[model samples]
Target: MSLVRKFATVASGTLMSRILGFAREMLMAAALGTGPVAGAFYAAFQFPNTFRRLFAEGAFNSAFVPLFAKEIEANGIDGARRFSEEVFGVLFSVLTVLTILMELAMPLLVRTIIAPGFASDPQKYELTVALATIMFPYLMCMSLAAMMAGMLNSLRRYFAAAIAPVFLNVILIAVLGHAWYTGADSLEVGYAMAWGVMAAGVVQLAIVWIAARRAGISIGFRRPRMTPNVKRLLWLALPAAITGGITQINTLIGTAIASGQDKAVPALAQADRFYQLPLGVVGIAVAIVLLPELARALKAGNDGEAASLQNRSVEFVLFLTLPATAALLVISEPIVRVLYERGAFTSDDTVLVSSILAVFGLGLPAFVLIKAFTPGYFAREDTKTPMVFAAISVAINITIALTLFPRMGAPGIAVASVVAGWANALMLLVVLIRRGHWGHDAPLMRRIPRLVLSSALMGAALYGGAVWLSPWLAPPASLLAQTGSLALLCAAGALVYFVLAFATGGADAGMVRRNVRRGSAAPAGTEE
Candidate 1:
């Protein structure tokens, strides 16, 4: 299989999860809208979710995969399995204790760290505490699940791990949709979703754990033995954890500040749901696949191959991101209106979330580029650099968000995050260049300008398409009409971008087809 197909396999799974996640969010929004119930739930969910993203999608994967790949290469599968068992043991034990502690401290933690703004309302504050406590053990399930996923990705078994997240969305959508249909009270619905989250966590862990077992990489609990390699893994993981932690903390800060404003919490969450669709399918997929591929390339002393992989990953990700960014920027309101304007989700909610989504679109490319580029350092076992850069980005985010929120409201928080995202990406790229890690290849350099041009053309086309489709863009009409309008605008934009890309030789469709057909799946010369 080719790299594209491997990425597609992972991406396809993610695409499904993302699609289901969109459904889940839409259901949740209609059920609760940007009301206090939605606010409390989002705030509570972010508590663990912020940390989950840190480990599952962010630092742990960066630290674990390369080291695991090296262990497999140097010491064979037996040694690698042993390493995984020890790590899993440690992870399970630590998270078990952590979950207990967090559960015990749920109220205090909610009052302090998660959302102090809720303190003014006894009922709201207590509900968030209860909601978060129900979901806290998700930390335990997901921590182990993340390790299992790392094991699977190291073995180039991407599908199950990539698709496991869909269970979460599935559970949530089922619960939320049922609650909505039954006209469950907001309080009843919130608790239902909270418990549903924890249930999904168990199922998510089971899915990946079973997949790893089927792949002959069952990570049973062993004694938590900290060998030299374990130490090395922890050392590498520490900085990456801090980096992921800092970034999540910045998000927490944004949420905390946003929570103070009326309805800002759910507004931001709604906007995040839309933007995360593209980010998940493109950025997350590239990062997960790129990290190990680059690691193996460097391990084999194929610097040229490593550089090429990085460049191609960047090009491929940008090819998707730029146009998506344009569409979101151009058609955010209509998209949000079409998706979430029913039930309790009001016109005011649409306006706020859409504006936030549009600003977030500006940073979308940078967010994905950071995901694509950070692997350059991570693949080389250097997490401290990203840690430093992440700290810088966090500081910038806090300052800008704090400064702007008083003036611009929830949208300002989104804009601050966008600005900080660009700053972080630029910094990482600069460092990668300075350290001689990832130099831009000639192809990358040549094609980027053209990619931008193609994306611009698509953006214009989408803008015109949206203008033409406005009357049919919103409901009080048929769902078919509204969905058809949005889908048509998106398809037209995609058509324009790809047509221009192939016409100008910006992206080689034939090459993509050939490569995706019979080309590098895990790179040209890596162990399977």
Candidate 2:
């Protein structure tokens, strides 16, 4: 498949997931608001999610896909199937044990790692621990899901795995909406949401499992044994896991610092939801789909093809991510207000969250680029290089967090994250260039100035629209006006960005149309 079609398939599924995620957050905002209950729920959600990134998405996928692809290329389908089964057995065993331990240790873990916000309020702290315990088991299910997802991506079955996350939001929204309709207390409804997280994990896992089966990759639990391949997988996974941990340390630091400020944690969380929309849809989807292809191309000694693929991935990411960053920065306020300003979510909360979203927006491209670039190293089986960069990024994040938290609070931490992201992206790019693995292709270089100009135009239009519409769409203290204004702002930004990107050379309509046409003619599973 052409890169564009691969990306489109992944991006379309991710867009569905992001939409559902938006709906889920909207329901959470309306159901719980930005109070202690909301804070507790967000904190609880972050606990499992942090590990989910560390294990399932970051570590496991990065380590698993390259190896699986190599096995498929070398020994064919049965060898790849055996490799997956072995990994699944070990992963399931380890994750089950880890989940039990995490659940049992939830209170202490929350006290140590997620304790900042709860220090002033003992009840909130305890509540977070309770909620975290209910949600911690999600890691086990999601870890298995990630393994399944890695297999699917290796097999080029991107649709189901990409779409599975939408189920998470769907389940959460259904649970919360049902509770609200039954007139449950806000706290009770929030707890129901927490439990719904676990249910979502089960559903995600099942969806991916079915996809895997359909792809002729059936995974089962055999007697857990550390075969040579299993050991090799673990060895690769260790550095990757540590890399994820180091990267997550920044988030932990932000959480620790944000915990001390009332509503800061949830504000950052809500802003992240918006930022992650583009990051997940474009950045993550590209990384997942590209890594295995890159790995196979490199392993087959197709350096030129690998280089071309890398260049296309960069172009694809830049083409989409540039405007997304601009739009988010432009429409941060309305996006937050429209989606989150409800029930207990006050106008003040909307302002605070939107400020953080803008800060996050500045780093959105950097974050997306990291996803685009890291696969270059991982596909080369060089995990440690990215780990080194991750360590530096973590240090940068920590320095900014400690230095700025006293004066700026949560927004400061958000800025720190953005700075860290840029630092990481630059470091990765520098290393890639130094190694001669990635360089500026003429096409990418030619597109840069026009892309910037287009983004600038979009930003200007969005800012002007925001200024003009502020009075009409200014977040009212009322939920209805807040929601309506937010929606208008987002619609305006989307219109402006799309028009500018099309008019400027930032988006090549002919090239995209040609690529899509070529992609349609290609058979499934035909790797370019």
Candidate 3:
């Protein structure tokens, strides 16, 4: 498949999951609002979710995919399968132990790492512990699932891994819908959502497991042993996991800091879910597809093709992310109102969430740029460089968040995260260039400024459009009217950006087509 085609497959699947995720959040807002229960639930959920990003998606994808692809190239299917089974055995054993330990230590974790602020309230603190214990095993399921996902990505089977997350949203939405219909209390809903998260992890893991089986890469049980390949994987994955999970780590810190303020946790989470739409669809989709393809190109000694792939992937990310950042900044209030300002979620909550959302918008491009740039290092087995950069970013995030959160509340934390993200992205890009792993492609250089200007213009248009449609997007408007107005604004923004992008030669259909064709061709000096 072409590179863009692969990206579309993953992005479309992610977009589906994200849309359902929004629905789930909307239901949650109505049921719980930014209440104490909501705070507990989001805090508990964030722990396992952060580990899933750190260990499963981040570590496994960064460390496992490149090695898995190399295994296929060097040892063929049998060797790859053996290696996979070996890693799975170790991963499963380690996760089982880790889950038990975490569950046992849930209370301590809650007080220390998850939410120190909650400790002052006995009800909230115990609730967070119980919820976290129930959900912590989800980390085990998702980590195992990520190993299989890495296998699938290496095999060029992107759909299953990408679409599997939809089940999480599906199950949670069902739980929330039931809670809403039955008029369950917020505490009841929190417990139900926690269990729903655990169940969803199992289902998501099964989906990818089955997909991997169908792809002819069934990995079965083996005794946990540290053979040469397994040891090598561990060595590589240790740093890569940290590097990959930097964003989550930063957010985790922010969450801990924000926990001091009532309703601040859910507010930040709500805002995060909004901006994550573009980040997941564009940044994550590009990263997932780019890594294995770039690794394969480099492994084949196709430097030109690898460089071309990096440039194009970055171009593609900017074309999507720049406009998204603009729209989120320009119309955050209306978007939050349309999505979550009903039921228990108040207009005051909307104002708070939207303000944080706008701050997060300023960092959208940086967040996505981190995704686009990290592969340049990971694809070359240089995980430590990114790891070092990630540590620096985390330190900066901590310092800034601690400094600001006391006075500024949740928006302060958001600012720290944004600044940290930009620091990380710029560091990665600079290192890539200084090390000569990346070249300055003329076309990419030319298009970036144009794309930025196009997004600025689009942002202005969206601001005017929002003002003109204020009545339709405000609280007095019906749900249909609000959603319709918001949708129209988004569509208009997209139209304006694309037209300007193409007219100004920032992007074009021909460029996309060429990338598609280029991706389909075999690397130079390599047989089909």
Best by lDDT: 3
List the candidate 3 regions with Cα displacement exceeding 4 Å.
518-528
The global Cα lDDT (0 to 1) of model 3 is: 0.92
Better of 2 and 3 by TM-score: 3
* Whole-model Cα lDDT of every candidate shown, in order: 0.85, 0.81, 0.92
Native-to-model Cα distance after best TM-score fit, residue 473 in candidate 3, in Å = 0.7
Q: Give me the displacement of residue 111 in model 3, in angstroms.
A: 0.4
**Prediction 1 global C-alpha lDDT:** 0.85
Clashes of 2: 2
Q: Residue 152 error for model 2, in Å?
A: 0.7
- In terms of lDDT, the poorest run of 10 residues in model 1 is 519-528
- The candidates, ranked best first by lDDT, are 3, 1, 2
**Candidate 1 local lDDT, residue 90:** 76
Winner on TM-score between 1 and 3 is 3
TM-score of each: 0.96, 0.94, 0.98
